[model samples]
Target: MHSRLVAVAATAAIALMAPTGALAQDATPMASPVGESLFAELGLPELTITVTDEGIEIDRSDIEAGRYLVTLNNESAEPEVFAGFVQIPEDRTLEDLSYADEVAAGTPIPEEGPAEEDFLWLYETYIAGGPSTVTEAARQVVVNLPAGSYGVWDEDPTSPRLAAALTVTGDPGVRVEGPEPEAAVTIIEEGEGGVGFSFRLDGEFVAGPQVVKVLNASDQPHFVEVSQYPEEITVEQVMATFMFDPSSGATPSPDMLDYERAIFAGWAGTQSPGATQWVIVDVAPGQVLVDCFIPDPLAEFTPHAFEGMLQLFEVAES
Candidate 1:
């Protein structure tokens, strides 16, 4: 069974966003460069899943069951979340369940426990969140679906729009190449910088229009934002945008977004503790800044990146 969390389709476009469940920290926006670890060669079946707090969008609702490269892209604002998985007992069809109303109202789906069904578990992944856009980019995950009905739900299981039914038909699958992964980068969320949460990368950033994956080694749920610092902005000035500094209450400069110094690379969504997912993205080289924008609920929703969970990498042109 395979399931993907967050991935940006390989491109120079800004991709993926991370939205935490219910909390503001879950919606930290990020941008990052893609490293060519692998994925230059695997050709597997892939599907595009676009989601928001309101509803879910599966490019192809009716598909043959098998192993697939699924891209989970959050194309809305904060608090919106989405995920995919197959369940044995499909209580109802996608039409039987209601979704249009909730999406129209832009209401967030409430979290729900697994439904009362004595069904065997199939391939799945914990829901990942990020509020960027497909126009910007997206991430990837590999999931195996045996011919069966599946549920693609979010944090809110109680939500009418929460669990939608997907019909997977055909024989079982065996392919795992497209989403396995080639290049990898480890993000350590230790408070190394002493300001907030410090980030340490164990690999180098590479450029590509390839499939990708990310592994989170930190306790806090996290995502990757790749961009470049502004010529005039100071790292301290940028960090000030995140937390309540003891020295002074330094907030992020409004000009930061208005001026736009961080050249956008792309973003991936938040991964649950120790879950790895794949994403396809195109990356450009430069002085890249990797950080997590998930807010700390304990600290007035301060972004982890501001607190100190940030690292700088030089993406060499390929």
Candidate 2:
């Protein structure tokens, strides 16, 4: 993969796969007094995880299946962190999951992997909760966890090597509903050569802090990265920058786009088909870009964004 493409995907993965916290008024949101007040309104049990150069520390690891306000306080030397929890089946252990290496390396795993590599999707499908963005600033997400054994881990191998265990005890059959979302975003598959997988916004996005429900209706697992692009930048430009060609080894230039100008608002973590989660979105009145970078094995591993999974939503003043 081109360094440019890898960089962009890596950035999104870091933000979308970590233990997020509350949002502030700026593009790079931080946990603030106002944000904490907003979280209190969710009325969900708060699960706080503190990360440092040593490792990860969770205030509590045992709980029943239910929705929670997951917050990550990054106090490490690293600029960003990717930390999350995935169910480790009774028959499996952390050693049984080979995809951890790729994750720790910040590589984007392709969907529909070969027979031996099928665990990639399996792992994705089993992600119980905890999706985040790259930030030293505190951020958070609302997630519903099922009863199961889980492993909390950091995506970067060099960063603290945290893989603590978690236990969510409850009946597997019962489904607990999460808080109602102020806005809804659905991820859908477009079938073969039909613009691939894309996002379907159920309604207009209103500015300021709000809970955005993200549902994955596609066959394969998917995640979303939310950002605000300058109005002058057209959708065509974004498409071109995200375009990838495996055969020619072609990739977008690192200089093709100015990342500093792209303001990251939030991340709705990876979800398997029919899964739903809610993320905290706090943006000023502007255009917010929703996209996915997961590679499609059925399409030479091209990113879903290049296949038309990227869309701009108008955020009206609240």
Candidate 3:
């Protein structure tokens, strides 16, 4: 949908999720760096991870229920990238992960979805963030959790980091539900609207932690940002910030994260044609504006929003 622009915490984890297609199937073992102070800059509880030619390992296995920044430290000979996902019910193991089988068996995610709404929940159907590479600095996801068992499903099953387990003790603390693609907002690029973006929301205003599915209905890859503009702000004023020319095909550089200008809601990372991924964003009660900042790389990197990929919607009380 209009990717998210506000509330980047839980959404960042969902937004940074890498697609399985990019993961290289390898037999090499992997392990996450255990306890380390790398997250001092972030000032959040750090869970450093290392994935290499070894089995999965963590700094400390027991973590109380709360929010944390899950960072990956790659020490493999070759470039290594990874993604993390957590599920409730201590009994659900990697081998037992049969959501598809359930689908084939007539049980679906909607019915079998984690029934506990009070605890942290996460489910990713479509891949997000393209694919995360561990070589470039540290890859991270900020997540909240509760007291229970968590299955860290490394996006790729082949990696040594696959099926890592993490235990959470104490109370359900802060509830952080994962991203679910139950709702969708198909982003059409250039069909009836000429050259910009349009939206197809799932319903009126069904609330909860939502996994907004964004699709690139256009020929070119695109991204969307959900932001809140001040009442005085106009589309023309915002458009001026981007210097893009369709004919020139020049890549216009604009500040993607302008937290000072407007309220950053959440994001829909760049998506390829026919590619759809779920992005997490907590929709609050107010006016939410959606815009695409990605330039049409095929069209000389012209900003899609200038071509008409912008709109506004309201989030009423559910």
Using TM-score as the measure, which candidate wins? 2
Identify the superior model by TM-score, candidate 1 or candidate 2: 2
Error of 2 at 288 (Å): 1.3
**What lDDT tens digits, residue by residue, belong to model 1 across residues 194-220?**
236666655656665444456655555
User: In terms of TM-score, how similar is model 3 to the real structure?
Assistant: 0.39
- lDDT by residue (tens digit), candidate 2, 136-243: 222676677888887666532222245667798999888877665454443343334234878877766788766677776676655676677555456766655544
Ranking by TM-score: 2, 1, 3
Whole-model lDDT, model 2: 0.57
Please identify model 3 stretches exceeding 4 Å from their true place. Answer: 1-180, 184-197, 200-208, 230-233, 241-261
Model 2 segments beyond 4 Å from truth?
1-34, 95-124, 131-138, 155-160, 178-195, 243-256
lDDT of 1 at 232: 39
